[model samples]
Target chain A: MNGEAPFVPDERDRALMLATQEGLPLAVRPYHALAERLGWAPEEVFARLARLHAVGVIRRIAAAPNHYALGYVANGMSVWDVDDERVDELGQWLAAQGEVSHCYRRPRALPLWRYNLFAMFHARERAEVERAVAVAAVRLAACFPGAVRAHEVLFSSRILKKTGVRLDF
Target chain B: MRERRPATLDDLDRQLLWALQDDLPLCERPFAVLATGLGVSEEEVLQRLRRYLAEGIVTRFGPFFQVERMGGAFCLAAMAVPEERFDEVTVAVGAFPQVAHNYRREHALNMWFVLAATRPEGIVETARAIENAVSLPVWLFPKEREYFVRLRLRP
Candidate 1:
């Protein structure tokens, strides 16, 4: 059996995740502060974080702005039913656009759901998002004519729950 | 529900938001490194970041882990609930630890949420449990392929 083995973080790695899960310290020397707290050298903390990043465990160390707080009140999940053969290509084009925050190719659920491509976009106003999506559709038609069949935008009305995943070591 | 208003920000704060979206360097003085690029003092950068967090302008600031790379699974699941039971169903669904984020979208499938689990089977199990709790069929739309996913936002 050639099942891919799961990556189990070592004690130090687990500690690192736990420490930075909430967020990294806002000190002048954040790594040094982490090292002092974790009882490791500053170099060791940096090396471990670098290794995690290299191995694709950490996507990035960056700030996530709250869309609502930034005047982007409308969050639209624009989905499309594109030609199966060219869906991936069109999806890549959509993803490259700055307006699209998240784009993915998901399976259609037959009669209930017909959209296979999902692109999430945010805007200060719902109309702005719709206008931008229309512009994008025009561009897609020009580049990949007849590739996109139908599309719809689903705006999130409320956030029922928002939280991060917690892993038990 | 908490009220949300756009925070008034200066040009420096705007620039800082744009700069912070990019990956910070792995160095001894990372904030200082960012300060140099932003042409501001390190203390200023730190102060603004702290304020942003405190004011909920920035949801999080740190390393984003790709759980899938660590043998975890995430599934985007949705459900169509009767309007009367929507609130009750939301609480039942949110009770599951595996449900990372839930959103109410304007669609027939009005309730959507993401499930993140340590193992792939955990997702299936949690979905089954949620279905049992809510008595609604959960439509799991796992990503067949990812084209792009950049979570940065312009302030």
Candidate 2:
């Protein structure tokens, strides 16, 4: 645990985050409908969400989809080792790729964990993901010789869960 | 030093969440569909969702879109925030509108956050902002391999 921050959500705040995370009700007056059920006034429910957003508790209220249903059948986690100085530059370049959904750098395990830069390539199949990785590897290796050392491709075996914040109140 | 209380779930709530876990209807009147399926009024369906949300049993209930489908740039990044500055660094990193969710996990590089940008530049700009705000080297750990694991809590 990082330096523990005291962030005990009040009952109302907790409810708001839960609702935002779970799913906003499909109603014309969604806030009002939700408020009516929670035994609170609609104004209060709306106000609380606004407040949470202001305080950064609830990041953004949006809808996502089940990707597999949409034909994106394959996902690959790709890792790379790039020059420390150019990691940001290369990361930005890789992030630009439409097929690459996720890109970031993680602390590498000394000696063993030499790779730092990571990009997640997703496509309709393993071959598509591999092709994307191949192109990216070539583009990245051209800049930093011996900088891009190793890469690993881990395919998703199963999806345990995809829901946001665990509500344990 | 302290007592740990176990969380409990009732059958109906479990049923409601289980119904929503995977196949949330996508339509103009999704509640109508849910109501018909559950043999309850649309208001009753809404009420159960409200109760679940209030109880903190479900964090979010809505469409889980594939980011790639929507033409967005997203990545999960982690930084080795020094123990002393962890709080400050997290706050700084969380300030970015582009950041979706951040968590503190048990690892040397503790602070982790997800960045979703409408444009590619937004990702780098966010990293720069975080680095400048925290006054520490913000390591961008993008996803190398994506294991799509659908996690569902069994009641």
Candidate 3:
């Protein structure tokens, strides 16, 4: 996904990220061009890309459209508290959810922040976001017998320096 | 932060945008690949891309990486600021180089920010520094597992 789990990119992964991060070339065989630049076989580069994409290391080889332009003006980083033991299944479900663009099972900072499950919900407006949050909350509550403890939809009133996270090694 | 503006799209622009998202083609002269698919010229494809970049319609025209794999740490953090100190604290938090994103949200934890740091420890260090600077408790929520993270907006 976006800010995926913590892990060090191998030399090869670093090479790929660095070489292609500046936008792939506008050539017939862009990967072939990438191969030529990296001094590796075009086929090898293609295979590596396929592998990385499969493993979620490379989310997609696509254009990240401006969400605001796409009508999702108001987006909320919806965080929830659920029994940690029961989060895996719920997180997986949320990941597959059409609206939950990004889903993660983060560690809980108890007493202060008990939200172990974070799902990003986007919509054209705040009310839509609240409705989506309510839907997801209901589903999560079903999975967990205990009170959700806290469900907060942090609707960003302002945004600063938003961009895709990169591995710039 | 960016303002919400209407991004007018022509049929050609929409076609080109779709092509760019669908795997930038894995062939020689990839733009030509897209051009051929859209029944346009390779030069036209290149021109459109340049314009899109210049116009800020396309923020990035490349592969998006899994940041953590590249030896970086990203986290969602927040602080509850007094109404009087909201702007002051927002400026203070925005000053950190690692603060990739800071937002004003409506909730108890009103001030929210995303931190992308070179090292895992850097996230904690920055959080602590911000907490001390604003004299408020900073709650750090580091991602333990990523279930899904794809933002596909079909034009």
Candidate 4:
């Protein structure tokens, strides 16, 4: 099964995602209601979801929050270019930082873009963020000498949408 | 810092993730409900989840909310840090509470990280802080237009 094709969602799984994504009803036994509407037993619906998750078809099923409502107003994306040998070492360290929420490495764009490290951070104020970044830079330098080359910070001005996958079932 | 690696997930792991992606049951016996539907016992469901988490198959297993909806300002920022100072730069950026995620891409402005603040001014202030700390001019690249921002893990 390791090399088998990824499990594709059938009509039933697709319908469940569509209904839930559109806006799950805020009533008691929402899943039961969803099952009723879809003409499936509640247990069966839940079971199907579990199976989907187990196969890596879905990442998680939980309440995605509205960060703005929670007072996390300022957000930005920061990237860096470090020594290839130490990139993973630095990446792991950055990922552990509370301020740095999302950290990943993607292929560089070349000539113009040569950096290879990235992280995300949210704050209540820009000044606080600046202070945090400054400290992070110093710490990173201490950990790996001459690893960081260049870095740029971009702030997201607007939020288009932050939803899960829109698969074609 | 640890080595980087991709996660290896199986069919069962994918099903669990799909279910959790939508929303975990909000009940006293949520696992029970999930297990019954999957034709497995609650213990089995929980055990597999725990194992997947331990193996780093799933980055996180909790709520992912819309920051702006909660009355917050967020932006995507990138900095041009040289390879020599990459580690130092990341450490400096990661110290802040607002910094949520950071990525390294192949670009002049390589180092990219996300910043969020409760107030609008916080955005500029944070950018400036990073600028002074890194001794590099940090360019604030706020999203002017967003065509798409969804992660389709499965192809």
RMSD of each: 2.7, 12.6, 4.5, 15.8
* Per-model chain A TM: 0.85, 0.81, 0.71, 0.86
Model 3 lDDT tens row, B104-147? 88888888788876566888988999988889999887778888
- DockQ in order: 0.65, 0.06, 0.49, 0.05
* lDDT (tens digit, per residue) of candidate 1 on B59-97: 788887777877888889999999999989989998888
lDDT per residue, candidate 1, A1-169, as tens digits?
1145656677899899888877888888988988888889888898899988987778799887777788888989999999999999999999988778889999999999999999998888999999989999999999999999999899998878766565533
lDDT of each: 0.86, 0.59, 0.74, 0.60
Candidate 2 CAPRI grade? incorrect
**How far out, in Å, is residue B154 in model 2?**
30
Best model per TM-score: 1
All candidates: TM-score: 0.90, 0.51, 0.75, 0.53
lDDT of 3 at A117: 86
DockQ score, prediction 1: 0.65
C-alpha displacement of B42 in model 4, angstroms? 23
**Per-residue lDDT of candidate 4, residues A1-169 (tens digit):** 1245445566786676656654444334556776787888888867866676666554455633333422344555667888877777788887777677667665565665565666766775566666777788889989888999877665544332233222222
- Fnat, model by model in order, equals 0.79, 0.08, 0.67, 0.06
lDDT of 2 by residue, B46-95 (tens): 77676655544444565332233223456666677788876666567655
- Among all windows of ten consecutive residues in candidate 3 chain B, which has the lowest summed lDDT? B64-73
